[model samples]
Target: MEDRLNRIESKIALSEDLLEELNLMVFRQQQQIDRLQQQIVDLHRQLASGSPGERRDLREEIPPHY
Candidate 1:
């Protein structure tokens, strides 16, 4: 019947819309993850290089009572 066909078409349209929204969300999440990964790499490089005025032998500061 025509009524049944109309209902099926409406359902299909809704499903397509939902799929598009889900794809957009996934793309945004992937962008954020990429940005965070880059930030972590930059932090690792900074720590490895050490900062100005930093002492390399600070490990010798352990108290005699230890």
Candidate 2:
């Protein structure tokens, strides 16, 4: 019947809208994930460069009178 066809069309439209919304949400989430990943990489680089190049050993120190 025509009524059944109309109902089916409406359902299809609604489904398409929902699918588009979900896709947009996924895109936004991926952007946020990329930004966070970049931040982590930047922080790691900062930590690596800020540390001392080498550590000194106490055993290598000579006694005060030696």
Candidate 3:
């Protein structure tokens, strides 16, 4: 009777802790997703700003060697 109640209470506490941890994990993942989405938007804008007919020179991308 009392022992059963204690076990149930213990289980409930563990479940609550697990739920909180899961919620925190979800929140962190959402933040990362939002940042990634913003980065993608920025990249798209950068690409769109370049002239459509222009070709980037490969040599221009090379780092200068001393």
Candidate 4:
């Protein structure tokens, strides 16, 4: 029947719209994840290099004989 065909068409359109929205959301999330991963990698590299700004001293005391 024509009515059934129209209903099916409407459902298909709605499904397509939902799929498109979901795809965009996934793409945005992926971009955010990539950015975070890159930041982590850069931080790791900086830590591994032992940059002067990241150095710390934990000496307890100095001897008086020096």
Candidate 5:
């Protein structure tokens, strides 16, 4: 009767706490992913712009014997 009801209430409370913790963890991970994505975009922009000293030529990789 009352004892069974108490047990069920306790289980429901624990489940609610666990759900909140999982949601917070997922939110933090999403923030980290957003930051990493921004870094990738910045790097791509830098590579594409190729400012002076950052220039790279693929034709430089030729063997001396050729």
Candidate 6:
């Protein structure tokens, strides 16, 4: 009976540790998601505002070797 109780206690401890690790992993992922979301929002604002300077000809973008 004592041996069975020890095994159960050990399993519980391991489960608690795994739960903590999983929670931390989820928190880090959420932080990354938040940063990506903010970047997307900033990009949208920049596009809506348009280019800051004079427009260039598309031909100018071609490589000289072409």
Top candidate on TM-score is 6
What's the CA error at residue 18 for candidate 3, in Å? 0.4
TM-score comparison, 1 vs 3, better candidate: 3
TM-score of each: 0.73, 0.73, 0.78, 0.77, 0.74, 0.83
Instruction: Compose the digit string of candidate 1's lDDT tens values, residues 1-66.
Output: 999999999999999999999999999999999999999998888778885347758787898899
lDDT of 2 by residue, 1-66 (tens): 999999999999999999999999999999999999999998898778976346779899999999
- Ten residues in sequence with the least summed lDDT for candidate 3: 51-60
Residue-wise C-alpha lDDT for candidate 6, range 1-66, written one tens digit per residue: 999999999999999999999999999999999999999998888778885457789877988777
Residue 60's lDDT in candidate 2: 100
Assess candidate 1 and give its lDDT: 0.92
Model 4 CA deviation exceeding 4 Å by range: 52-54, 57-66
Local distance difference test scores for all models: 0.92, 0.93, 0.92, 0.90, 0.91, 0.92
lDDT value for model 6: 0.92
Give the per-residue lDDT digits (tens) of candidate 3, residues 1-64: 9999999999999999999999999999999999999999988887899844579798778787
Candidate number with the higher TM-score (2 or 5): 5
lDDT of model 4, residue 38: 100
Clashes of 2: 0
Which stretches of candidate 2 lie above 4 Å from their native place? Answer: 51-66
Clash-forming residue pairs, model 2: none
| Global fold similarity of model 6 (TM-score) | 0.83
Flag regions of model 5 displaced more than 4 Å.
52-66
Q: Which stretches of candidate 1 lie over 4 Å from their true place?
A: 52-66
Comparing 3 with 6 on TM-score, the higher-scoring candidate is 6
lDDT of model 5 at position 20: 100
Tens-place lDDT per residue, model 5, 1-66, is 999999999999999999999999999999999999999998888778885255558798787898
Ranking 3 against 4 by TM-score, winner: 3
